[model samples]
Target: MPYARLLTPLLLVCSNVFMTFAWYGHLKYRSVALPKVILISWGIAFFEYLLMVPANRMGSTVYSAPQLKGLQEVITLLVFAGFSTLYLGQALKWNHWAGFGLILVAAWLIFLE
Candidate 1:
C-alpha cells in the first residue's frame, strides 16, 4: 500500500503529462496532415491509458473513486498548464490561475469529510 501510495500519484502525474501532450500537442501540428496527427495522438494516448489504469487501481485502495477522479482532473489541469506554458509558449494569466484555484477548492470539497 505504501508503494502504491507513492506510485499512484506518480503514475497519475505521468499519465496526465502524456495525455496533455497527446490532446493539445496536435494543435501545433496543424501544418501537418490531420491523419498523421491523429495517428500520433492515438499512439501517445495508448501510453496515457497504460499509466492511468494502474494509477486508478492503486489509488483506489487509498482513495474513494470520486477522490481519485478529482485527483486525476486536478493533475490533468496542472499537467496541461505546464505543457502549454513550456511547449506552447503560452503564458498563465491571473484568470487562469484563479480558475485552477477554484478547481482545487472543488477538489477539496469533494474529498472533504
Candidate 2:
C-alpha cells in the first residue's frame, strides 16, 4: 500500500504526458494532414490508456474514486501547464495560476475526512 500510494500518481504523471501529447501535440504540427495527426494521436493514446488503467486500478486499492479523480485532475493541470509552455509556447498567466490554486484548494477539501 505504501508503494502503491507513490506508484499510482507517478504512473498517472507518465500517463498524462502521453495524454497531453496525444491531445495537443498536433497543434504544433498543423501542416500535417488531419488524418495523419489523428492516427498519430491514436497511437499515443494507446500508451496513455495502458498506463491510466493500471494507475487507476492500483490507486483504487488505497484511494476512493473522488480522491483518485481529484489527484488525477491536479496532476493533469500541472503536466499540461508544463507541456503548454514548453511545447506549445504558451506560458500560463496569473489567472491560470489562480485557477490552478483554487483547484488545489478544492482537491485538498476532497481529501478531508
Candidate 3:
C-alpha cells in the first residue's frame, strides 16, 4: 500500500486536533475579549492548515479528490467526538454515538471498489 494512504490520515488527525481547539476550545474562556480569542484561534488554525495541506497533497497521490474529502469528514467527526468528550468534558449521548455510527457506515460506502 502507498504510504500516502497511511500518512494522510495521520496528518489529518493531527490537523483536526488543532482545528477542534481553534474552533471550540475557547468556550471555557468566555471572559476573554473577542478579538483576542479570534486572533488566538487564527494562530491555532495556522497549524491545522499546515498539516492539512500536506495531507491532501499526499492523499491525492492515491485517493481521488472525493475520496479524500469524504475521508476527511469522517476523520473530523471521530476526532471531534473524542475532543468534545475528553477535553471539553462533554458526555456523548446514545444518539450522538448512533449518529456517528451511521456516518461511519456512509463513509464505508466511499471505500467500495
Q: 1-113, model 1: which lDDT tens digit per residue?
A: 87887889899999988888888998876799988988998999999999999899989999999999888879888898888799998989999999999999999898998
lDDT of each residue in 60-101, candidate 3, tens digit only = 999988788889889999898998889889978999999988
Clashes by residue pair, model 1: none
- Flag regions of model 3 displaced more than 4 Å: none
> Compared to the true structure, candidate 1 yields what TM-score?
0.94
Q: What are the runs in model 1 whose C-alpha is more than 4 Å off?
A: none
> Which tens-of-lDDT digit does each residue in 1-113 have in candidate 2?
77889999999999999999999999999899999999999999999999999999999999999999999999999999999999999999999999999999999988999
| Number of the top lDDT candidate | 2
Clashing pairs in 2: none
Which of the predicted structures, 2 or 3, would earn the higher TM-score when compared with the native? 2
The whole-model lDDT of each prediction reads 0.90, 0.97, 0.92
Task: Quote the lDDT for 83 in model 2.
Answer: 99
- Spell out the clash pairs found in candidate 3: none
The total number of steric clashes, by the backbone 3 Å criterion, in model 1 comes to 0
Candidate 2: deviation at residue 67, Å?
0.3
Q: If candidate 3 were superposed on the true structure by all CA atoms, what would the RMSD be?
A: 1.3
